[model samples]
Target: MVAALDVGGLGMDAQVSITARPEPISLDPRRTAVVVIDMQNDFGSRGGMFDGAGLDVAPIAALVQPISRVLETARRAGLFVVYTRQEHNSDLSDAGNEDSPHRIKHRRMNIGATVEAPSGIRSQILVRNTWNTAIVAELEPRQGDVVVSKHRYSAFFETSFDTILRAKRINTLIFTGATTSICVESTVRDATLPLHCT
Candidate 1:
């Protein structure tokens, strides 16, 4: 009856113990959450944004059903659910802004942009915008779920996800969907709370 959860950048494992005369405690759905990563059209199924990065969407689409189920279940249980997607300025110049900090790294790394354009101005990654940065359509954002815009690979990095989680007192998180080796991995590496990744 014990489990680990991931909240923001902190990871904590909690075990529930049963006593002889235990007081049955009701679970608080308000303390739980689920984070879905990069469920957009470009990085998701069919016409994703990552196609230019030599990334494929067919595999990411497989999680559609599972992620949808998690969304529904978490909502019903009153758990705060969130999603993150990687997006950049259309001009690609803002990525290098000094104040934002990500502006520097994003400008240098250019995770979304694969190769320089033939003219040496843009990149092939800009063509689709659907593959590299777009969230899959099947698992689109809803009015209730928190949608976060991530400039870096990790959703927890330089994003408002943590702020909202704290505001809602969400402690536990379940992560599912898209780019297991990329965005998903990055999130797990940074998540500090107790979490169950399925």
Candidate 2:
């Protein structure tokens, strides 16, 4: 379905129709942004959080190339690109204090435990500025792309993500990343809501 917006700015129109489930969606680069969510080492690489917990990283690892291609295409089309990292504060303050459900869940998973990354660096799982929280080398955010660090599964929750999109006058989003049923799905659902952007 084509839902064209005014998208003022001479010579900025570059619309394309992408065949998708449910219907064919029209994309106008001027009004759209591509959100790459939680494609971090802790979730997609060996010796990181998911791998340390015995979860298979193969599936997540396989996505790097495809997502890279998508990002390249988006850039060429002049679409705004945003990358999100799921991470917590180094002191664990923002991870929820004193047996909160958030902290409990993380504890169960040993979320902050130190683990040796494939790069031979020992880093705390999902902690900001650590190897585990960094986006994989293959999909690093290029210059001119925005990066946001989110503590929760949904990037939009208590984050500047929505505000950033609104400031860019973005009305359409293309989401791609790890854990389709979790972080990715959560962000996509949140994006559907109307925000009273100034």
Candidate 3:
């Protein structure tokens, strides 16, 4: 059997057992969320940003089915679902101004350049509302899933992601998606910090 999230809950106070390092933990399903980060075409699909830059995306593509299964299980357990997309304005204003690290990084990657995806759609890489930033078909957000558009690797940066989680009372987060070392890790770090506390 696939090692999906072991979520078992019933009443409002139901909790799921999780095997963690150092010690085991239990969490309420109602207060948990599955956060899917940057599973966009630009990173996982052929002829998208990663492919256009000559990077191998097969491993990223391979994750879709497993993630889909986990998502389905989460939904069945009534866990909240949230998706984060790395996107910027068409004019790149949100990416950052000249000499800024964000703009410099994007420029190094040639982000926003027009490219023809394998799907035959012409789209600018990582631009908001474009095909490149759309979640892969296999894991598209269903009704009631929150889609958070982020301009940086960390989803909480200048975005409503944290607010949405707080509003939904989501205290536990189960993350899945591409670039585990970069975007995924960044979001995790931000999520654990008490940045909002004054």
Among these predictions, the greatest TM-score belongs to: 3
Ranking by TM-score: 3, 2, 1
Tens digits of per-residue lDDT for model 2, 1-198: 122222345375566777678897776778888889999998898877888888899999999998888887777667799999999987888888767877887786688777777778778988999999999999999999999999988999989998898889888888889889999998988877766233
- What's the lDDT for all of these models? 0.60, 0.83, 0.85
What is the clash count for each candidate, in the order shown? 34, 0, 0
What TM-score, over all chains together, does every model reach?
A: 0.64, 0.89, 0.92
Best by lDDT: 3
Clashing pairs in 3: none
Per residue, candidate 1 scores C-alpha lDDT tens digits across 115-179 of 54323443434223434454566677778888887767788777887777878876666677667
* Root-mean-square deviation per candidate: 9.4, 3.9, 2.2
Q: Give the TM-score of candidate 3.
A: 0.92
Candidate 1 segments whose C-alpha is farther than 4 A from its true place: 1-27, 52-54, 94-134, 193-198
RMSD of 3: 2.2
